[model samples]
Target: MPGTIAFVGDSLTAAGRWDEWLPEFTVSNHAAGGATTADVLAEVDVVLANRPDAYVLLIGTNDLAWRKSVEHVVRNVESILATVHKHEPSTRMLVQSVLPREPEFAASIRDINRHLWQYSSTVRAQFLDLWPVLADENGALSPVHSEDGLHLTAAGYELWLDALRPAIERLFAVPTTTTPIDVLSDAISVSGLR
Candidate 1:
């Protein structure tokens, strides 16, 4: 059976047409323009209400833009994950790295992504690093990906879809021992993360 996936985040996620890119699964973009990590925390109820089988999140850029420290954003994200697990222990999760932006905040973005990547592993969520594919040689958001240096262009969205496809396939792949959903729920229970 095809699984349902929700994309939750800011404008970067809001701007994508996920259904068109991944027709094999049910996709919903629950993102809003100019939203931050705090905004996502507020949307937790709405996001989980849908009862999606999986979720892909890419937030924190707007938080950084609003001058919130990277650590603050990370903490908010960890809380968000905990809440998600509490509500739906079996859902698959993929936390994408915060995208690279203009030069001035490049280092901060990288630091946030680094922390998020590590946190994802600890929480049993997969981390998808966008920097390698989206950043230019100088570590800035590649102009080819974003026209305004923040939001993605058509090509950028395509790249994101391409990068995410394999993971989605692996996530929805058939299981050997038990149903994948049951396995995930059991794993979460054993980890005491819920």
Candidate 2:
């Protein structure tokens, strides 16, 4: 099998079907109904125990719901990054941009995404922009992608996959073969990273 990857997030990441969408990687998601960075940190030990080769963080929607400032959320994210550094130092990172919420919260969502993009550069973390995938022309969640006007429906997750696949493929292709080569390792080694 390919290296294990863990996804830490809230409801959207836990939407009961990401595995069906992307089966190429071994995905272990630790997501709850309303998880925040704080909640994720609390359970990271369990996730780290898996010796994940990478972590895909899709949190912050709950923080946004709580009306937390972008800086505060980034601080939480930074703390998670530090945790990853200590435990999974060799792990690559992929951070999905916080999706836009309701129209009233659009500014805050934009603010969070701006900081996410800026800070993603600072940390060499790959940033996946959900804004394009989730937002309508007016910058709220596109009705097509969301059922609750916030969380994803099947179509929303499809949008997520469309945006996410390129990055995930790129991650899998990279030579993170940091172990005794197994059969799965050899398969990737021969194919080369696209």
Candidate 3:
């Protein structure tokens, strides 16, 4: 069974009905519309207080919108992850790629995503590359996914959920006994046999 989860990001995250969508787990949305990485850093403590079993992060786009350098966004994100890891080493983390926007932002977004993917490994977090699923041939947020090329439509959210659900499940999945002896022991216990 899934445990508590915290979703942290900007408008894209703030708009999600995570509790309704992920009824299996306790959900907390710590996102705010127009929020930048610095903004997330300021309010990260509130999210930590929830003590969620996992964290799903999706920031940086707003920072891009504000013309913040890729390094600025990446550094802030690293700080967020480091702070969370320091406070809750056992908590799992899922770092999502910054969704595509206008074509001009595509390259920078990819750079941010790559850095985040690498950084996630350092913090032992899983990275979800949403680009292939969300971007169009021109490397912009597909119109099918977003009307404004930034926020998602219902269909977009559906695609995201399709990817996100499995990742979350894997993050919380209990390891099964693979050894023959352990399997036999489990079977015996289940069958009420000595």
Candidate 4:
């Protein structure tokens, strides 16, 4: 069966050619350049309205560049996940870590990724840590992958695609099943979303 997937985030996601990269699925790119986590949170309903079988989120780097606190970004992301899970409990979700950038922002980015990983688990969303593949020894975005230290090069996108494709396949391979309403409600409550 063909599945629909929505990509939501900032420029990194906006720049992807998902249709070409993953042609088996219907792809919707809701990402925009310069977007922050707050931006995605604001328009989450629009993304949800697509009713995709799965969602791929790659946000938060822009927020870091704008100097937003790590907690602020994490909270906004948590709200986004809670909102999606509330509306589409059966949908699969993959939250990619904020990619490495300038060295100065590495620590904060790592902090946000850690929170995202933990929170994604709580919400039953899979988290992809891009650091191992995209970060240099100094923990900055690798120059081979990005010339501007912010945006990715062709090589970077290829690496990203390599990491992402298998995860999506795994998501698709799983048979879809409905969670009982009581269990779903409990998960939402335990997730700390109001």
- C-alpha lDDT score of every prediction, in listed order: 0.83, 0.77, 0.88, 0.89
Model 4 residue 130 lDDT score:
90
Candidate 1 least-lDDT 10 residues: 173-182
**Regions of model 4 farther than 4 Å from truth:** 175-194
Q: Name the lDDT value of residue 137 in candidate 1.
A: 79
Top of the candidates by TM-score = 4
lDDT of 4 at 194: 40
- My TM-score estimates for the predictions, one after another, are 0.87, 0.84, 0.88, 0.91
Query: Tens digit of lDDT per residue, candidate 4, span 34-107?
Result: 99989999998998887889989999988887889999999999999988877777788899999999999989
Error of 4 at 137 (Å): 0.9
The alpha-carbon RMSD values of the candidates against the true structure, listed in the order shown, are 4.4, 8.1, 9.4, 4.0
Off by over 4 Å in 3: 174-194
What is the alpha-carbon lDDT of model 4 when measured against the actual structure?
A: 0.89
Ranking by lDDT: 4, 3, 1, 2
Q: Give the TM-score comparing model 4 with the true structure, all chains together.
A: 0.91
Tell me the tens digit of each residue's lDDT in model 1 across 1-194: 58899999999888788898788789899999999899999988898999888878999999988999988999998888777766676677788898888888888889988888888866557888889988997777787888989989999888888888887776656332223455777999999998
Model 3: per-residue lDDT, tens digit, 77-148? 999988876666667888899999999999999999999999987877888999998999888978889999
Q: State which candidate, 1 or 2, has the greater TM-score.
A: 1
Candidate with more favorable, higher TM-score: 2 or 3: 3
Overall local distance difference test of candidate 3: 0.88
What lDDT tens digits, residue by residue, belong to model 2 across residues 159-178? 78888888877766655423
Candidate 2 wrong stretches, greater than 4 Å: 175-194
Q: For residue 94, what is the lDDT in candidate 3?
A: 86
